[model samples]
Target: MKPSLHAKIHLWIMALIILVGLGLIAQGGYMQAKAHFAQFLIERAFEQTLVDNQPHKPWSWADTHPVAKMRLLQHNAQGGQQPLGQDLYVLAGASGRNLAFGPSLMLAGAGVGEQGNMIIAGHRDSHFMRLQYVNVGDMIELYSATGQLQVYQITATQVVHETATEVLDQTESSKLTLITCYPFDQLAGNAEYRYIVEATPLV
Candidate 1:
């Protein structure tokens, strides 16, 4: 039987919808692959930076370079802590582009291993997700470009409004302030509040 014009139009629309859906799925897969590849390159650059004792850009056009190495440790039953996972290479800037790659050091605060509060910001969904399990007494180790390691013990975890800039304030003491969006499990990003992890150097 010959198909009516209306039936043919519906068929075309359905075919078009399927094509669009497939395209979207393919694009998403491509994006994920690209992100993983980029991360691999960034890690390699960090290794080079450590060996050469210099900044190494992850990519040719990248504006940021690996500035430091960071690790988060979890408290064990014996009153000791063990490494949670792999060490994260800290980037130089806190710009969105840099944060997409890894935790970024905010230039507004003191430099790594320097006096005053050294602020580091990262996306909750990515590198800093482990910060959720971090509690007071857990330890954080930050290595400067010179491969100098500074150990800090977690002191406090606070939730503050995004407008609160006091966390970024310069202090007479050496402090490490880690910042991420609040509500770790929430799907909606750019939350009104921020999850802050404050740590002090271990003498």
Candidate 2:
């Protein structure tokens, strides 16, 4: 049977909408898969850095190299750290480009494993997603390229306004400050607040 002109137009519009919806889904899937695998390459690069004692780029043409490795931990009965197995590769610089691949060390702050505050920043959705789960008494570890381990205990956490640059200030004692966009579950990347995790080295 021949369809009416109005019915043919309706069918065409519906087909176009379906195609657009499918395309969106496919793109989203691709991104999720990409993020899942990209971290493996960064992890591998970190291993080479440890062995070579030099900066090893996760991939050719990347401006950043793995500078340190971080792991979450819990305190055991003996007050020793029990690894949570949440390893993250810390990149050389905290620029937006570098943060896309992994949490990065802010160049303006103290060097990793140094005696001053070291600020690391990552996207709330990806590398820093687990940061939201950290507690005040939990332990965190950062291992340098030479395999030197620095242990710290989480001291505090707060949500600060986006303009609160004071959080990046240097501290009298060694500290680890992790920053991520606030409201972790929000779909917007440019939130007006930040989630800060402050940790002090364990004696």
Candidate 3:
């Protein structure tokens, strides 16, 4: 049977709409799955495992403890080549973005209770967008299989140059330094400045 040109055009439009609908569905599904996987990883990293009323071995960064992976909290500035699911130490701020040179190895360092500063870097985008939201007295917590470590408010924010080593200076107190891209508006490439958020142990 010969169909009119209008019928053929309508059929093509219907097919195009169907394909677009399918694409949207697939994209939604993928995003949902990724979110679920990220949550799972965070939970697993924070999971509690006990041994003889103490704690399991794999939870800490001592004696071959498995590295705890981190996930960006969406809107994170640091873009990763891998999706949020792959088990890698997710950078939370500039350090996470500058994985090669910055504090990407923080997880492998002293877990939480050691002396000296514990610096962590993540992108301004996804990981530490909350930096601006952080108030002077707010509390930040880091979790691992062993237990959760709480850090109290110290300095909520600062700005430094990319060439400034003072931001990474050694501190007597157990500190956590989070770095991220600065000026927030420059999205083309790496910026010349950085934003730092430093916190101290509660006690």
Candidate 4:
């Protein structure tokens, strides 16, 4: 006996559904593998730029040594609260929360002593997500591998369009700027805005 037209249609529909499901799974796996490879590359680049030497004098930013990782802590400026930890990267021309630019990237510059803004940017998801919790008058501590510690107090916070360049400006004083995607809870598309936490050196 031959199958009816209705039965044939049902079989076709089931096959189509299975094919779609398989396609989605394959695409997901591909994305996962790609992300893993990208992370590996970033780590390798960070290791190559790690600095191991300390500066001879204090209160100086002249040494151009690179550090593998720097610890950033965000705390209340009143000196009575705990701080959040952030991963540090050394790169040039790095702004915003994008980190796929490659290794040897310096958000601003590397030195032991100098009065210049040492801007730092990290992803809102993995590296600097906690930045959203930072408030005005918060304290930020940047610890370098060379035993050099730079402290800054959060003086300002703002949400601006992703294209805004004012946040990346070079300042006369040694400053630190933290950048992350705005609207932390949003799940779709770019946030269209960036959250900036500006800190001035603690004297």
Candidate 2 per-residue lDDT, tens place, 15-87, comes to: 9999999999999999888876778888888899888888888889988888899998876779877776568
TM-score for candidate 4, residues paired by index = 0.59
Off by over 4 Å in 1: 2-7, 76-80
RMSD of each: 2.1, 2.5, 9.4, 7.5
Which segments of model 2 are wrong by more than 4 Å? 74-85
TM-score of each: 0.88, 0.90, 0.57, 0.59
Q: Which candidate tops lDDT?
A: 1
List ranges where model 4 is wrong by over 4 Å: 1-11, 22-26, 29-41, 51-90, 95-98, 101-114, 123-128, 137-139, 143-147, 162-164, 186-192
Residue pairs in candidate 2 whose N, alpha carbon or C atoms collide under 3 angstroms? none
Q: Tell me the deviation in Å of residue 18 in model 2.
A: 2.0
Summarize candidate 3's per-residue lDDT along 52-166 as a digit string, tens digits.
Answer: 2233232244232222343222223454222222233432232332343112435533444467776666556544555655545445555433444454454567788999977
Give lDDT for model 1. 0.90
- Number of the candidate with higher TM-score, 1 or 2: 2
| Pairs with steric clashes in candidate 1 | none
Off by over 4 Å in 3: 1-25, 48-110
**Residue 46 CA error for candidate 3 (Å)?**
2.8
The C-alpha lDDT values of all candidates are 0.90, 0.89, 0.53, 0.60
Q: Write the per-residue lDDT of candidate 1 for residues 1-203, one digit (tens) a residue.
A: 99999999999999999999999999999988987888788888888877988888999999998888899999999988899878888888899989988899999999987899999999888888889999899999998887889999999999999999899999999999999998889849659989999999998
